[model samples]
Target: MTVILNQSFTGISIGAVLLLIALGLTLTFGQMGVINMAHGEFIMAGAYTTYVLQKSISSAGISLLVALPLAFLVAGAMGALLEWLLIRRLYTRPLDTLLVTWGVSLMLQQLARDVFGAPNVQTHAPDLLTGNMSVAGVTLANNRLFILGLALLCALTLTLILRLTPLGRRIRAVVQNRDLAEVSGIATERVDRTTFFIGSGLAGVAGVALTLVGPIGPTMGTNYIVDAFLVVVVGGVAQLKGSVITAFALGVLQSVLEYSTTVSVAKVIVLVAIVAFLQWRPQGLYTLRTRSLV
Candidate 1:
């Protein structure tokens, strides 16, 4: 029972990280119909930003707190610039967007290699997050709990933004009917830019949380990119609540399966399950009624 409880905690922690990574991808792919293969690169950029911050500050707590906003700004700025320079031209061409973004992902990987070298770097947990607490013989790491809280907070904040704010309304309007939104005086272009920025910024924050789980590397984001996409797809694109729930579901399922089988085999089984589920319901677990971009 204790072991099971520990695994559950671990699963949720993993799920939280997945939620963060998928949040941004969902926003971009769901809202704009853009297949951004370089989304993982933005995450890599964030992890690298944290690494650099750790190096400069020499205080884990301060560096981490500082890394949060700085990583967001850096990744968001890069995302905004990329949207302007490349993604803007390929809005109507998803295949082209995929190819261009894939190329960009490769470029970013190479750039990280050139700048940060080929070795993986480690980022320490903050002093406050360095220990574990035990309850009923189940140990919970402070870092993992912090990550879970962060994920929930991010989800709530995003929900509020989308539900309660004018900008959120504009985003929804544009997603529903781009032409109508434009005609109604919504700055669709600005909305797109803002959405992309927030999406990429969320990916950056994911990268920061990721440092607590593993070593930071140029290709670190690639490790979880597929799982993140699966979360977005399985949850239903453009559905924030669905994404959050599906992420945790997959995370826990994977965790339980891993306890019984090899990690690779567990992933294969999960993939098969997701494939079967999709075959049954291609629209995903939840969907909102929105007009197609056509």
Candidate 2:
């Protein structure tokens, strides 16, 4: 029972990380219909932002806290710039966006290598997050717990922004029907850029949380990009609730499978399961209901 509980917590923590990574893709790819292969680089940028702040500041905790908002702005600005310079021109051509962003991703990786060098870097987590706590015979890592809370908080904040804010309403309007939204006097282009900013910013936040649990490096984002996309696709594009549910479900399943099998084998099993599930329901766990003719 104790082992089961521990694994479950671990799964939940993993799910939190997935949720953070996928949340941005949900906005960019899922809602906007742009295959941003460079999205992972945005995560890398956030992680590097944390690293840079830590180098300048003596306190790990202060640096981390500062990194959160700074990373978001840095990544969000990059996303907005990308949209203005290239993605905007190819919004109607997803394949072009994919190829272009893939090239951009490679460029970003090379840039990181040039700037930070080829060696992986490590961040020092604060003492508060370096310890472990036991709850009912289950040991919980403070870092993981912090990550879980941060993920939940981010999800909730995003949900509120989408559902209740004027900007979100504009974004939804543009997404549902760009032509109609423009006809209705909404600045669809600006909305698109703003949406991209928020989405990419979320990826930055995910990157910051990740520094607590893993090594930082130029190629680190590549390791999780596919899994993040899987979470978004399986959850259903544009369906926040579906992404949330799918993230945790896959996490638990992966954790359980990894306990009995090798990590590679566990990943293979999960991929197979996702493939089977998608074959049965390719629209994913949820479908968007839009009134637009297009």
Candidate 3:
């Protein structure tokens, strides 16, 4: 039982990272209706950004606090750029979007390899974020706790933006009916760009959060992209709340199973289960209101 508690906490930590990644992917897929294979590249971009920030702020030289949002901006800009150049063209053809985005992913990966090398890059935890905490006989890493808090905060902030802001109304309008939104004088083109920015930025923030736990590298995002897609798909696109629940549930499920078995086997079981669940529902755990695009 003690072992289970410890493992569960660890799993929650992992889930937090996945939540961040999946949330972004879900929004982009649901809103833009584009399947971007290169979404992971922004994550790598965020990782590199964190690495640079670490170099600057080491020993009172940098600010991890500031890096959080900066990393998002860095990744968001990359995402927006990709949308402007490659993604926009492929919007009408999702299959082609996949092809173009995949090529972009390759180019981004190779570019990182050229600049950062093939070896994994390391990021140091901010002094304030380094430590450990024990609760209910379970020891939890402070860094993980910090990340979890940050993840929840990001989700809440986004929820508020989507629910309360004028921009949010426009975003929802566009997602529901692009023609209708434009008819009402809503510049869906701008909304699309902002959506790309938010989605990419979230993934980048996830990359930064991930560096707190493990290795960072050019191909690192590849490992996460598939899982992110899984969470988005399982939770149902356009439903941020559903994404959170599914991500954490999957995370805890995978962790408990891994503790009892092999990680690979745990993953296989989880994937199969997700596939079965989707087969039954097809729409996901949550469905969006009537929308022409979805």
Q: Which candidate leads in lDDT?
A: 2
For model 1, how many clashes? Answer: 0
Error of 3 at 32 (Å): 1.6
Native-to-model Cα distance after best TM-score fit, residue 220 in candidate 1, in Å: 0.8
Candidate 2, residue 168: CA error in Å? Answer: 0.9
Local error of candidate 2 at 249, Å? 0.9
Error of 2 at 191 (Å): 0.6
- Evaluate model 1: give its TM-score: 0.96
Which stretches of model 1 miss by more than 4 angstroms? 290-294
State the lDDT of candidate 3 residue by residue for 1-294, as single tens digits: 889899889789888988989878887888877877888888888888888887887752255666779989999998999889877777778778877899999999999999989999787787667778878889989889988998899999988999999988888888777888999999888899999999999988988887888888989888988888888888987568989998898889999999989999999999899989988878788877673454
TM-score of each: 0.96, 0.96, 0.95
What local lDDT does model 1 show for residue 17?
Answer: 94
Query: Higher-TM-score candidate among 1 and 3?
Result: 1
Q: How close is candidate 3 to the true structure, as a TM-score?
A: 0.95
RMSD of each: 1.5, 1.4, 1.7
**Collision count for each candidate, in order:** 0, 0, 2
User: Candidate 1, after superposition: displacement of residue 54 in Å?
Assistant: 1.5
